[model samples]
Target: MSPRLVRIGLGLWFCAIVLFLLFPLVFLIPLSFNESEILSFPPTTWSLRWYRVLFLDTSWSNALWLSVKIGVLVTILSLFIGTASALAIVRHRLPGAGLLYGLSIAPLIVPSIVIALGMFMLFARLQWLESLTTLVFAHTVVAVPYVIVVVSAALRNLDETIERAARVLGADPWRTFLLVTLPALRPAILAGAMFAFFASFDDLVITLFVSGAMETLPLRIWNDLNLRLDPTVAAASCVMVAMSMIGLGIAEFARSAGLRRLRMENTDG
Candidate 1:
């Protein structure tokens, strides 16, 4: 095909894909407004009863708190382990780095069901079910590789000479890293942590395996969806999606700001 026609075709394809992906989200918003006793379309009245009911339910509030706590803990653990591993691989040039990196990334490629089964077995054997600590640890294992990949990319893009220069100026290794390296890695770290939070918050398989009595949002949603879905679920989904979108927006903004600063500094130099 001609280049011009190819461009037009690609544009049309992109638009079609975007619409297809967004259609369900668009449909759900209005559906959440339905006031019917059953979750049927074309409701006789539009009301806020579902939303009111959602807020009035203590179970949901507790679940939200639980999920938030897990997400934060998972993000922190992921950042610590992932950043350390990334720094070692990228900066220290550790032996078997490729193997280490691959192992770290294994969770992403492996079937989640398999991962869940393994976790469930481990928890059952250890009698650690319903422990948020185990849930955090398991999620951290899955979430860390993303942080590693992102932070390693940032480290790779950054020039090593800056840290070397700091060392030459008599700054200790710790000081050099703290002053020069960490600042440059901040944006990628922030992005990765945000992503980790979302991944853990939204995870169902692993959480379901480890969570016996503890109910995260996704588990709760899954159970409710399997039984009877109310417009409250839809409303809750809308709120969660909105929060995710906002977090994504902030991450993108931070990334752009970091890149812009880098470019300006390079231009000045």
Candidate 2:
């Protein structure tokens, strides 16, 4: 085939993939505006009644609040643990660095259900089930891998000479890291925290297994679906999508600003 033909084929393929992935979300967006009690296509009326329900309904509001709180905690815990693990693997010539790295990333490859089951059993034994702290810890297990992957890549690509220069200038190891290394990795750290936040916020499988009577947003949605098919669920989903987009936008802006500053510093040096 000609080069032009190949380019055309690739563009068409990309468009097809995008459409396939977004088709369901596109279908759902229309239903959210549905003023009717039932979820129907080509909504008979467009109103914010369902959106109002999401805010006024105590169950939904509480679920949303709990999910946000847990997500924030998970983000903080994951970033702290993951950044330390990544730094250890990349900076130190530890005897079992490769093994430790593999262990850190194992959750990503291991089936979520398997992890969920194990956590359920462990939490049950420890009598930690149905607790927010336990949920946050469980989420951190999955979220940490994302943080490690992002931070590890940033660390690997970092120019070690800058950190060495700080050390040579009478800076201690901690000072060198805080002044040189941490600033250089800030973009990746911010991105990783965002990933961690979303991972916990959107999680369902593990939450279902371990949440028990506790209701996160996903659990509330599941319960709603089981009880009845309400247009309110559609409104809730749209709100979740909006929140996710806003978060991603903020994180992208921060990451880009950090990158620009790093580039400017490198150029000046």
Best by lDDT: 2
RMSD of each: 2.1, 2.3
Q: Cα lDDT of model 2 overall? A: 0.90
Candidate 2, 1-269: lDDT as tens digits: 99999999999999999999888788789999989999889888899998898888999999999999999999999999999999999999788998989999999999999999999999999999988899999999999999998899888878788899999999999999898899889988998898899889999999999998889988898899999989888888888888888888877886787767767766965
The C-alpha local distance difference test score for the whole of candidate 1 amounts to 0.85
> TM-scores for all candidates?
0.92, 0.92
Model 1 lDDT, residue 187, Cα:
92
- Candidates in order have lDDT scores of 0.85, 0.90
Error (Å) of candidate 2 at residue 85 is 0.7
Q: What is the C-alpha lDDT profile of model 1 across 1-269, one tens digit per residue?
A: 99999999999999999999998787777767778767776566898877776667887767778888999999999998999999999888899998998898888899888998998998899998888898898888788888988888888878899999999999999999899999988998898888888878888999988888888877877888998888888777776788788887877777777777777767855
Which stretches of candidate 1 lie above 4 Å from their native place?
Answer: 1-10, 42-44, 265-269
Off by over 4 Å in 2: 1-9, 249-269
